[model samples]
Target: MSADTSAEWFDPDTTTFGDRLAGARELAGMTQEELAKRLGVKEKTMDDWENDVRDPRAMRLSMLAGLLNVSLLWLLTGEGDGPGDPGVATSYVRGGIQLMEEIREISVQMKLNAERLVRVEQELNELLRADDAGAA
Candidate 1:
């Protein structure tokens, strides 16, 4: 069986460099942290590039294209060759990628919730101490 190629993910003309970079990275089944580690940069640096807050330098851009198995021109201008055949296993891989992304998002949310809980606890403790002093 062959994978469907009839549906293109995005129009090349309309896609931005950051969009291409992110899509290629996801298709390559790499997390941002993993890609950053391989490129000898911080994960926040990769996030910045993917979010369009910053651009990768020429050397790093070339390396990203190579690592993601895409053409340099495609990564930059969304022209030239793109990713290769995803193969029959692509569906399973894509599912895994989605799950991983969801997990990462949830993990971030959990951390935020924990921080909020800590602050609330601190506030309650302060209020109880004030009440005790008033009663004394």
Candidate 2:
């Protein structure tokens, strides 16, 4: 008899579509820009999809799965032939996946904070200009 290994596989409940898409892209060795170009989409669009800001339509989704060499079901639900489990131990893969998820979360937070900073800077600049105008 063999051991049950479901616990060691990628868990869909804990991962988002963006996470799966990004992982597949990385495993396929294609940059977001390259994948976007191949799909005839803007790089920003790809980023939006991978960042969970947007999702692609069926056609684009199919193309993405094809390009990334993953099943569409797996891409959407993480339940099919996604990435192969290499010779590495399953526990190690699980740990690595968890780390990647954490890093992704941090990166998203940083992006949001950077956007907020840009808006704050713009507001400050406007205030400064208004003050200078009032002085004049």
Candidate 3:
């Protein structure tokens, strides 16, 4: 995900509307101070919203989406391709879905590979022990 927030991963099209707002805020290099200035909100208020400490009211959500230059639909539902670019949005959603499946598949494969490595290491240890015993 983008280094815009505390979250290790954030997909605007996949996260809740509020999360998308936070993510976009981060991407734009907006500090709570700067954002607050632009948004006419108190710093604590911005902080709470970003951390999910508080939910943005409906009117606030509309303002946030506009301020962040993202689509309201994407911000809220993780649906639609993106804000205004339908083609880009479609590609983004498709890629996000595909990437999730690929990551899961790789995780399973890696687990299997790790198991094989453990077995091989065990065999090598046994072989080394046999050599040492023979020498003794």
Most lDDT-accurate candidate: 1
Q: Per-residue alpha-carbon lDDT of model 2 for 35-77, expressed as tens digits?
A: 8887768999999998899999776776676677677899888
Which stretches of candidate 1 lie above 4 Å from their native place?
A: 1-8, 85-136
Worst 10 residues of 1 by lDDT: 86-95
Tens-place lDDT digits, model 1, residues 1-136: 1135324654787778877777777777778998888676899999999889999976677667767767788888888878654431122222344345445655766899999999999999999999999999
Better of 1 and 2 by TM-score: 1
Stronger candidate by lDDT (1 vs 2): 1
Task: Give the TM-scores of the predictions, in the order they appear.
Answer: 0.57, 0.55, 0.48
Where in model 2 is the C-alpha error above 4 Å?
A: 1-10, 86-136
Q: What total of clashing residue pairs does each candidate reach?
A: 0, 0, 3
- Give lDDT: candidate 3, residue 14: 54
lDDT of 1 at 102: 43
Candidate 1: the clashing residue pairs are: none
Q: Cα deviation in Å at residue 5, candidate 1?
A: 14
Candidate 2 lDDT (Cα, whole model)?
0.71
RMSD of each: 10.4, 12.7, 16.4
Q: How far is candidate 1 from the true structure (C-alpha RMSD, Å)?
A: 10.4
